[model samples]
Target: MRHAHKRCEDDGNWFVHPVTNKAWSNYTTCVDKDDLNFRHKINKLYISGYSVSVIALTISLAIFCYFRSLKCTRITIHKNLFISFIINNVLWIVWYTTVIRYPAVLFSNKPACQILHVLVHYFLLSNYMWMFCEGLYLHTLLVRAFVAEDKTMKWFYILGWGCPTVVIITYASVRSSYPEETILTPDSHQTRKAVRATLILIPLLGLHYIIIPFRPEPGSPEEVVYEPISAAAASFQGLCVSLLFCYFNGEVVALLKKKWNQVFTSWKN
Candidate 1:
């Protein structure tokens, strides 16, 4: 009998697993095998909306950052948030346009694949880390009632750009120790989900609830009036809670179900 799993010779085609011999299709390709016009339309709408929002946000941030006169200790946190938002927007565009649209390019060559993998993963992780930094800085200013006498621009560079760069370098070093192809299989997807939960999501949530609120000193009346840390804290808390639910209840549960199904199928066969 012919092998159940077969690898496609062409990178553009689907690949079959050696163990299960199951053919896996590339969903990233725009080719529509199924008739899902409504779904496709919705996706298009989402992409367009996201692109417009990103562009608007990027331009607004750029304008703000360009005006050095607007720089101040309090505004430094906003600047960091702007930088993070810009990077996140760029990453989103690249991810959707390149990885999602033309995934075959990812597996074209080892160097190309590695570069793409690093850029995609690094930017994505950095985006979240910078967001956490933004929250942390705001919390420090507001709740802890800490004020930096140093230049705001320098502080912005350190927290906004420096921290994310450090995180990216650290994550890249760890990932490079065990490099793999760009393909995202079901198993690899699960692993990525777990890693994100443990590394990014959990820590962020912890910072939002446990760390930021229970800092050295609660906000003074002046700090509360000027900084609005409580408002920011509430927003962070809501975001973290949403992410926790999505990962644990939604994504994790779905991945587990798929894994169990695969195991059951193998046993039956």
Candidate 2:
């Protein structure tokens, strides 16, 4: 949904808030009663979705760790990706509960809140970078079957972790130079659908960018229909990835079934 701004007065001045008696940007259209109720529902949905994702990702990580026989370069990359997703999901949950819910914290410009903001985005970038590592590894494996896995993993590690650190550090440095008043805070009425739209969709379609051209205009009726779907997809992305890559993996399933059969046999004896 698009934010509605108050029209300028005839004298080319901003309108005054009746209650504050000060010149302020009127944004009432963006946060009406119905929108608040919708935001409440979306908040609950995000918590529930992220909680499920955390559980799923944690289980996947455990599976990867416990199965020594399943260990490989690919599983290593998967483990790192799972860790990134887990941290990102937790950060989002914390963001919703603390920073997002409390306008005072944002207005106060607390260092902790700003740090959390950086950390949340750091892990988000890590998630995508690790995914890139996965693709690169697979391509190298196919094209140059004799390539040394151990040697390449070092480079992958740098790409996945080091690159994001460099980028974020540069970003934070540049951002900090800007004046405090120039910093834009998130509006309560503005959902993060666009920012998170590609989270799970990437796994389903490696080219999630295809949908970018079709994005509905902000504040259009189409946006009302799109926001919930985008949010839900982004929130549950970790769960979807864990399910597709870990729980449903052929080797993992076979190993688990074999373990169950052995346990059943021992119990029978």
Error of 1 at 149 (Å): 4.6
lDDT (Cα atoms) of all candidates against the true structure: 0.50, 0.77
lDDT value for model 1: 0.50
Candidate 1 lDDT by residue in tens digits, 1-269: 21334347677666774434567654435534342453344345435544554565555455445556546543454445545545555555565566555645654535655666666666555556555655554444434433453644466566556666777788768777865522012254644644544465445534544544444342344543323343344323323432343223453356557768998999999
Q: Give the poorly placed runs of model 2, Cα more than 4 Å off.
A: 1-31, 179-219
Model 2 agreement with the true structure over 74-115: per-residue lDDT tens digits: 789889889988998999999889977776676666678878
Question: Whose lDDT is greatest here?
Answer: 2
Span of ten consecutive residues with least summed lDDT in model 1:
181-190
Misplaced by over 4 Å in model 1 are 1-32, 35-46, 66-69, 149-156, 181-269
Candidate 2 overall Cα lDDT vs. reference?
0.77
